[model samples]
Target: MSVIAVLALDGAPGHQLTAPGLAFATAARHHHPVAYEVRVCAGPGFAGTGGPAPFGIEAPWGMEGLDDADTVLLLGHEGFRAAPPPGVVDALLAAAARGARVGAVGTGTFTLAATGLLDGRRAATSRRHTRELARLYPRIEVDPEGAAVADGAFHSAAGVLGGVDLCLHLITLDHGDPVAIETERQLFLHLHAQAQDAGGAAPEDGPGAAEAAYNAVTPPGSSLEPVTRWMEANLHHPLTLDDIAGRARLGVRSLTRRFRAETGLTPLQYLLRTRIQHAQRLLERTDDPVERIAARSGLGTPANLRHHFQRSTGTSPTTYRTAFRALVSGITWPERPEQP
Candidate 1:
């Protein structure tokens, strides 16, 4: 029964505008107890969006729609860098002052930052625009590469595709893990879930977890940093639960709980997924043999890698590599004969 105002300024991105609604709508369709009442609202005579997905829209509510919203989600538009429309910042301030969760997508971060809600906090936008965002808003801590970021009640992300990751993360926060997973499944977003890698990167977008993604969302100088870094450094070696706990200097039970709370995946789950993700990058970027890729990714053997890769990606290693290479490089690579 939470009211969500999806505020679209002139020229909002299509997916960022609709991805939240689509997620909640499907949540209800699948008996997930749709908790949000979403309204697509725009100011009077709002101009249509221009980039990526261009379309005109008519909505039933105006700025007034934000008055009762439990959440105000700002969607980016063509003139995202320009100052917000008259009364928009005031309306947003009023909503935030009332304890409503304010969210932003892509350049919408600019609008949110204009309201000073995101001052001194990290906000994310398209990696392409991170430089502009940082230059324009020096007070804001901008994370240009995050797929999505959640610090307290404020959230933001880099792209329209990231809207799904952002929404699902929100759904997970609002409901529980099960409900969010079900809703994502209902929405047919299994392959793109991008939960966590202990490094904070989303596999499909942004760079890999080679950077400090997990700690980025955790408290400043998290205790988990050293262990997480050690885990990432040793993914090529067979690691055990006890080994991880020893690295963290915590008992296994405590480690499990921390993993669940921080990353929404247990340590083993995170490590396995990270390994598979690493294998994926190898398959996509390298001409290495599957055996070597498996060993390096810590999957032990080719058969083991294949089993999990199929389960996680719905495609064989070879097929995944071909498709990804073709998509990213605009050139198809036929399979090379395996090295003995």
Candidate 2:
């Protein structure tokens, strides 16, 4: 099990700390034989946010816990508007020095950036704070809408609810795409149902926002859509830019330039992402055999599939499938849970 230490300082955003805590805890409970051991540590003299209602949280560990953790998550609070306190920066710097994977949620990047750990690194901070973050840390690339960004050993999220995205993304990192897909299906469907009942689509894709963002940059007739469709259809067959350009009736130069403009990725890179995305869907939603899945995703051999799948997600395809199947069928790990 990976050991995670969450460093909570005074005035910490309540949800920022609790979101990761609950996500890992729920994952541990549902999967059993816990995939992680989570420690919630407080900085010296930390009294939390003091709450609208009084409460007390006794810390069993302190900054020292961060030293032993495989992953250290920094929780940022209102106090982070200025530079992080000296102690907080020290603990984060030490964790990074020891080669630990580090991350932040929402404005927590402020603290991580203060340590100089994020210099020349990409990070995500809350949209409201994006300009300030950029102004403060000119060396750190702040992506406003990016779900999460991993620069070297640092991972960061852009907003409050991006916590769920961060957790699911970490699930993708720790388990595999298949596991991540199943977890996303569960969480997404629940959230979607809640949003529908609340009379609004989810904030990420509510009404015209997604389309507006898409159109604001790339108008219709851009090279991305057609090439993307072609890749999806011909993924099983060997593909080439010449063939794509011919099918799309565009010159290679036009196709390449426009494709990159629309998607921010080269045509071949987009093809690979599409293939992997398809394979991930298959792994999560189907009982198809692995060999068939490899062929269906245009990935060809099982060895190739395993190689890229593990490379992208950190776990074997079979392990991913087993975990996914268990989760979807309402079965827990180790021993299957009862199915109705």
Candidate 3:
């Protein structure tokens, strides 16, 4: 069984404390053979007085709980801007030194940064804090666009949803794609049901009602949801601006203007990004040859796929696959003994 130690600092967000456990429990339920032990470790001076409400939490473990954990997660707290409390930095350093995967969620990156572990590494945090993090730690590269970042054994996430993404990512590294996908599906369904329950009454087709309903679930660019969903469904096809414009029932120029205005990308650019993301998923989950994967992802040829994959991800497709598999298997190939 793998042990995940969540370090809950004073004023820690309730979501951060519970999200990892929820994700791992869902994963364990989906994949019966893999068991996970999630322990919440209270940091110094923690009184569970923070988050959206005032509540009391009695953590089962203390800082020492991180000693033998396979993964140590630092949860965001209200006082993240301040230096970490005594022994917190040392404990994180020791955890990293012992080969445990260390992660931070949102402002928790500040605590990890206090340990200098994030120095000279690309880390992600909430966009609101990216400037502050960079201003404080000039050595660290803050990726505002990334939802989550994984550099070696150190991971960081942007916010609550990003924290969930990070947890699913860790689960993917441990159990591969199917389990992670199932876990995400379950979570999505649960959240959707909750949204419906919270909504209570059916929305009437009054002025602004449609807009409110749309904004409730979708982001700013979601006016083009149908078009984007169609684009995703047909990524295997040779789609062009004309095709997308036709689908959206707009002229090419109009479509380009609206697409860029809403989604901040041209139709072609969005399609390419979508294609690349699809290719990455195929690389992670399938053993198909590069040529087949390329065609399936609408990148046309293996050369085209390699060119874009390398450009977008800074690594070749083959190399990315090998590295990802190594991460999933938890093996460093260089240290493996040669078979007779």
Each prediction's TM-score versus the true structure: 0.56, 0.55, 0.59
Per-residue lDDT tens digits for candidate 3, residues 128-157, read 778989999999999986477999999988
Off by over 4 Å in 2: 32-34, 50-55, 187-340
Q: lDDT of all the models against the reference?
A: 0.71, 0.67, 0.75
Clashing pairs in 3: none
Give residue 201's lDDT in candidate 2 (0 to 100). 35
The reply for model 3, stretches above 4 Å from the true place, is 197-340
Model 1 misses residue 327 by how many Å? 13
Candidate 2 C-alpha lDDT tens digits along 1-340: 8898987777665655666766775455333223687898988667864343324577678888888899998776656767676687888888888899998877677888888988988898766778899998899888877567988899988644526667767766776554455455445434433444486533432211211011011223554555566678888998888888888788989888877666555666667666766776798778898899999988899999988766654456776565555445652222111100
**Where does candidate 1 stray beyond 4 Å?**
189-340
Ranking by TM-score: 3, 1, 2
